[model samples]
Target: MMNDRNVVPERRFSADDSISVVETATGKRVDRRDFLRLTGMGAGALAAPALLSGGRSVAEAAEVSGTVPNLLRNGTYPVGLWVAPPPGETTVARYAEIADAGFTFVTGIDGCGGFCPPGETATAENAALLDAAAANDLDAIVYDHRISNIQNHPSEQWRDVIESILGEYQDFPAFAGFDIRDEPNASAFAQIGGINDILGQLDPGVLGYVNLFPTYASADMLGTPTYQEHLARYVSEARPDFISFDHYMLVGARPTIREDYFYNWVLVRNQALQAGLPSWVFILACEHYGYRLPTDEELLWQVNVSLAYGCKGIQYFTYWTPPLPGFHEALVTVDGQLTPLYYAAKRINNNYLQPVGKQLLPLTSESVAHFGEAQPSMGVEVFSGDEWVDSASGSAAILSRFHDPKRPNQRWLLVANREFESTANTTLTLHHTISAMFEFDTSERRYVPLEKAEPTGPATLAVHLEPGEAKLYRLHANQGD
Candidate 1:
């Protein structure tokens, strides 16, 4: 466990509102302005969160002693990676990289296929995977042992397979659950749901994992009148514990981005919320099948947009590089070298996703609003320009509203930059007085105070958001001074 006192010393603001940051090596005081500029705070506004433990923020680290003390213990949010570990490399370091990046869970197999070395029994493979996961206090989603497409397979056979896998590996402390299938159509739900129920009966904690197809799936392939209908049928038949889906909306194709990209999120999010189930969505980690490689801003946009919709979990499509053609440049290369994305992923997860995801797990998303004409899901209302002091900054952005039962009557706002190519400087003039405002310190995994708005006639909060960056503000008029 990290000791808070040793990390972030309290900030002492200078007369000019320039805060002091102590340099770790020499104990020299660095001006906050210069520190932010150097860290590209204005460029991305990532500095809003006190980069705490394991990432960048000393002050945030000082505050939240153990954001997650036991790695996978306290967290209810499930952050999973579709691992593509290099063939023949099952070292502790390999798995440790996943854990160190703040992912709480790992899928035992790779993308586009199951475990390689087809002769390897899923049971043995899962146990070995568990060994790696356990070493880092992470969990593994048991994948196919020998059976393939068990979800589409006959229900009785699927049960037998699920039972066999669980019987042999369910005892492992690191076993998270079994991956039944990926992107199942509506017709397969009844059988898969039965298998899910059986898997649950075998061990209640083990999830019946089945990721759904996104709205991008053709209407005919969906087998339902609409994508929404497709999901409705799944929930009714499959009886899943939670909902999950994958949409690679960042394809820089004809539209430059998927037209239904934002729509997919809203649809799945609403469906999951209505069913009273938490949902998980995947962000693209590799370029393939016409999807271009993502820049850092694009990556952040994917995550922030998901978070804005109140997703309970964030799943990366690929962690290790896939050996398949066209699917290249994963966080780790097929040859076992680290890719640049590996480090960037490390920063985003530890610095933002994991911490914020954990914090929002229990809260429910009440509503989502998009600012400007470019974003927001289809049919959703866009924020009017009159609502803010200046609309130019947030002309294209995401505004998510949430309700936390733990703090009755309290609401939270998550503001995100819509575009991935530049920064957004938004001056928000609240229609009402906000009690307090704070930025979630990803490093500390706790809420740190934001300076109070100047006492102008209208309470205005000047926000500087980097491309795809998000600012979380807590509203509590009752606690206002």
Candidate 2:
């Protein structure tokens, strides 16, 4: 039987759909596809093109020459944050916090509600924010308030607003793209074609960002699908290159809501997949609407869970905490302090994310197998510099993404953890004999030995994770195969 501790409550499948439970005492197994259906990843989860990056070492170049290439051509995995100003200052200390916290990008308002400094001043203020971010080696993106409800205007008015915003950022490099409409309704999506029509006329290369609500009411109620279905249909037709999603499981009194969170994200990912779009996820950073701040374990669970499922980019809903009397539970405090959430984020970024991105930057996401544990999801057959390592096994294992960054003979395998625990004892027993080194957990980010007990036998690898962690291992083809 799966350990109760590993079985997160909310996403738990019904009794009938339970998977094989090996009674620890009797050594007997029970058959449960219903359980697998509840947890089993459909075939769609397992498909992705893999390739290599432009920069490759000499040994890596000698491996496999060509394979599946990633849809996202180049760049490291980007860690992003929502931009908001401090309560009193046009200048916020969080800009520095983002850098200290080891982030790659920060997104913020150009000045919303007119309370912000006017025109050029606002642009300069935003520019200064970017300048601050750059000092820390972080990129910045601009976000305007909800466009769909701008003046609660009619469709034409909304289209004009979108066009106007796109026009403003046409020449701005510091500005990535507008978030478009935050949590837009069906009307907004249906009218999206027109909005894009306006944007195309103004700035053809700008991206249209959409953050959709988790659930929605449909005409048929019972037969009506969830909002994700609608989102998928819209994105597939719209064909936006990158899609963003917001997951707020803690919004209500759902104490055990973690399981539903991944499913909700997958719902939108399915939409992105059908649309042939790449996806990014926004994880909750603040305690919203009575929702408590996430515990360290829960936070780590969310990050590793996301990487397992295939989120190229990870975004924190709010990096600069909003003040008290409203949203008090924040990832970072108003005093520019690091909360439990902040440290959790640091541990994840420092120990896991960056190192893994360095190794896996060459691979593409090839296929997936999302079953076996509480947060069960795995992507298999990714190439690490042209070396294909077998998929992870056991209840919870590594989530893989493969890529070839235009470097003909090189590839990368982005292997991330599937569970939240700071340490994992699972081993990858490959069919081929090879020696590899991985940077694993605790004190002084050092390289550890990958012990090989035999010459021709499968390699045994054990890892120690620091909460929401990730690591990369590079192996030559002969060593890996």
Candidate 3:
């Protein structure tokens, strides 16, 4: 339901305009030189670099080898939402609705309007929310105002404050962890790390989560010279339970995607993979600012692309619509009615994400490749002959390869349709070493055998992908190799 009238004029930088600059998201103008300095980009390079290759280089500096730790209690791939039901509406029915939509966890349990209301403590509200989540079989990540601003208190009192805040909720079956912070600056990593350390000691079973900013953030906002440094500092200093970040790329009144979308994913995925941790992303679920409300295909596109990048968890930006200017229509309306996005999310969650994500949990990402024209400028490998795949041809797509540590010869490939609005028909030419192939059946929650190609020559399989859809295939390699 995006229209031309919603299109905001594209802000382009000009060489002549050396004195001033227009912000990319907001139209507010600021001093050009100052902006460039803050972003760590030179005047000529105001736009994203042809490639932010530093992050990739850092990832490639060592062999890609790490064990992805399981942080969730239920051992399910996390499908979480940013805002839970408000304090007044924290009922069993509402939580049940979320579970019915296929979410395994809820992140914002302090209150729906982003924080607890006046006179109501986050402890009290979160206790009630946890009870509701327990009733519905969903995990809750409690958000406490004191813990989020732990740095403001004297560093000496950090332990006492954190323990006091998390003590009661740690034992709850529904309690997953605490939302330590979101989009924190690099300067705050030490404090965040201290908090994480304390949580590890006091409640070793719980996760102390903190989500990082995307690559598009200003240098001043990131408190680092480059996005690469920001991620590096966070991992080294914060020592987080898992890596999480948000990058809402499908935007604009006319609904064009951002160039840095895949770049951001590549950086985050590499950082997480290098650290031997799981990565989570906040996918856009609402229309806010100039962002268009996503169609069903766009929603699927975001989830499928995140999976293609080896993401282990999916979080929606907002589950309950925020009652604020420029924000509109999330999965649920402000007054508690379900929006079309609710059903769209339900279909995607139940039909694709849940099953595929669980199946991918025990596997390690080996490599990812792109086929056809219109690929991103960076962080993607061109599809060529691999050990098992001879070649892949046809419509543009992404193929992510994975392998189970216990069964190294068995490979898993997830093929995602790059086009959000159209179908893609691709053909995969397999190497003779691939003895058998099977597709993961989401509905049946099992892998079903794929029809064998002619035995006389190299095997080929035709894959048809709907807009924003992906298919998972497992291949067994011949031991003789």
Best by lDDT: 3
Q: Per-residue lDDT for 1-481 in model 2, tens only?
A: 2222222111111122112221222333322222222222112222212111234322232232221111133365777776344423334355666656667776654433112212211343445554565556665565443442344456657756565554444333344444455444444455555555554444444445555454422323212255655675556444455667666544444345544565665565566556655667777777644344677766666666666556667888666564323355566676556787887788777666655544443344453334225634222223222134443454345545344546433333334455554455445554353445343333454555555666566664554455445554443335223
Model 3, range 440-459, lDDT digits (tens) per residue?
Answer: 89999999998776867777
TM-score, cand. 2: 0.64
Candidate ranking (lDDT, best to worst): 3, 1, 2
The digit string of per-residue lDDT tens for model 1 on 206-254 reads 6677787777655555667799899999899988878888877666442
The lDDT for every candidate, in the order shown, is 0.64, 0.48, 0.74
TM-score of 3: 0.83
Error of 2 at 6 (Å): 22
The alpha-carbon lDDT assigned to residue 278 of candidate 2 equals 64
User: What are the TM-scores, per candidate, against the unseen true structure?
Assistant: 0.77, 0.64, 0.83
